[model samples]
Target: MSILANPLYRPLFEILRSARNGIVYGGKLRFSHALVINLLYKSGPLLPRMKSVFEATKDHAQVLASFAIIYKIAVHFLQSDAVLGRKNLRLTKFLAGCFGSWIVYSGHFNLFNGGITHQITLYCFSRVLLALGKILLDKYLVCFQPSFINYQGDTMLYKNLNGHQQRKLKNLIYNKSWKYFAIITWGLVMFVYDYKPQYLQSSLRHSMTYIYDVEMDTWDTWREFLGI
Candidate 1:
């Protein structure tokens, strides 16, 4: 089922639809927020990876544009919540901001570290994006309504999470998921770093190889410098 078809997400969909209609008929300049939302809905899987491209291409303007769109969406969600008193709206705005910030940070970092293979940056950026999703789901269900999850033999949306299963799911989403993503990103970063020497040695004229070498070296040194 489409996310909007689910009762749990119907409210959010209504709000977004209303906002979309408002822009279409109310003559409001909502393109900024609309762009982000459009990309999110239409390119859900690729949304995170696209940020890497923006960064690698040094498209700061596009990155900022995307952020601006997300910012507008945040404001819209907040205002809607204030008017409609849907508590989830507040959390939704919080999620958007958190996700938006992480995306911007990841994109900017990837762009600045553009000396490496875009694939490496793409992988890291995707992890960051996925981390944001996990954070949203964790924060919403754990903090807002720990009892809203269902964990019996058959899974269904909007069911309450039992005590035993709650702890397990919470640990899985909040801790284990993040830990796994971090480890994978670390491995990829290290791989790029170790291969940098070989890649640059073969193609000295390849500026990106050099960039990768420098970026990876700097990251390694920083990690050791901080003893992390």
Candidate 2:
């Protein structure tokens, strides 16, 4: 009955595993690594705690936390590009807003949990910020790459387009917008879910700590064995 062994966990695990594979076996390994690390910190551990806020019947916060981390990582491949498409000023402003909000939320959560030593809900806030930063970095890297966005060796704007070109432009706009909306919506859902008392538990209140302990040891072993 372990959450990690459950069928539902497979999808999340596969995504992370695939990311690891891409990092190891595919090109752009640094991109994959940056992406995975960003995801692990933000969505992995904090997801289940957010879920525990609403559903009292399910007793698997730790598992959810693990999912959150995995989910954060998987979605980044989809979301970061959207933020990068915007103007630099707008992107910077949006990220600044998110950072300020995170600081307030983190401070409040830490204080509510009793003190800095308690560190409640900080991971959730920290993940949100990390996600935003990753998007910025990804976009910056893309900008330098040139091949993805350059058209006839031009980076400037064009005022006119024919039917075929317009259709392609439309698709690009829609695709970016759809992804941006999805990421924002998902992030908002997590924020709302994390605020409820039902999800909030005293530290060490989870049903399974052994799984995390095992996973931690496994992670360390892999890190050492792989020299990663």
Candidate 3:
């Protein structure tokens, strides 16, 4: 049976699909059209507000990633019945994921000086709003129906498949090796862009320098920006 046919898993699958779509599409826009618009066209009354919003949400990438990972782990445990008898496991998992991600990411990659009180408050509030929105939508939306597949008795995919094959299939889908490689490659690319902004198109370099206030000609500003 297909995983999407299972009611219990369908919502989670949809959520994951939506997340992946947003990451791909939104990332492309950020690097291309959005970057150009923000740099060149964003001005007048709206520019300050836009900048403020960007600053507030600048360090939220790690927090969002942490939330996704934790949410997946929590769903896994819930589906496997690992925490069937445990009370508050869901809450604990959520808190741990949020706080742990924030602490690790902020400590290592924090670029701003002074305190992070505002950032922490904003992150927590954003999470709360997201949870509330999801709950409301799930409750009111009639489009999501239970999967026709029998998720309790047979495996999600290829019910007749052997245990080893099922495990292999699961591993193929959930393996982290490729994800790590992608992350490393992305990090290296970002490092290059930051280290040598001049390598990019002149317009983009100027825009980036303007927004980030980085002096690409010298190491002193870069070091200071990195808090080294």
The best candidate by TM-score is 3
Please give the distance, in angstroms, between residue 147's alpha carbon in candidate 1 and its true position after superposition: 16
Ten-residue region with minimum lDDT total, candidate 3: 141-150
Q: State which candidate, 1 or 3, has the greater lDDT.
A: 1
- Per-residue lDDT tens digits for candidate 1, residues 1-228, read 877579978655655665455334322232343345345434456766555444433433344444445555664565574654456766666666676656554545463233333333454678779868877986787556634334355653333655676667767667776788789967875576566645532323244443443544544487785545
**Backbone-clash count (model 3):** 2
* Per-prediction backbone clash count: 6, 11, 2
Model 1 residue pairs with clashes: 32-69, 115-208, 115-211, 115-212, 149-160, 149-161
Clashing residue pairs, candidate 3? Answer: 5-147, 7-147
Deviation in angstroms for 11 in model 2?
53
TM-score of candidate 2 to 2 decimals: 0.21
Regions of candidate 3 where Cα sits further than 4 Å from its true position: 7-15, 21-38, 41-66, 78-81, 84-90, 99-228
Residue 18 displacement (Å), model 3: 5.4
After superposition, candidate 1 runs with Cα above 4 Å error? 1-128, 131-160, 163-168, 197-228
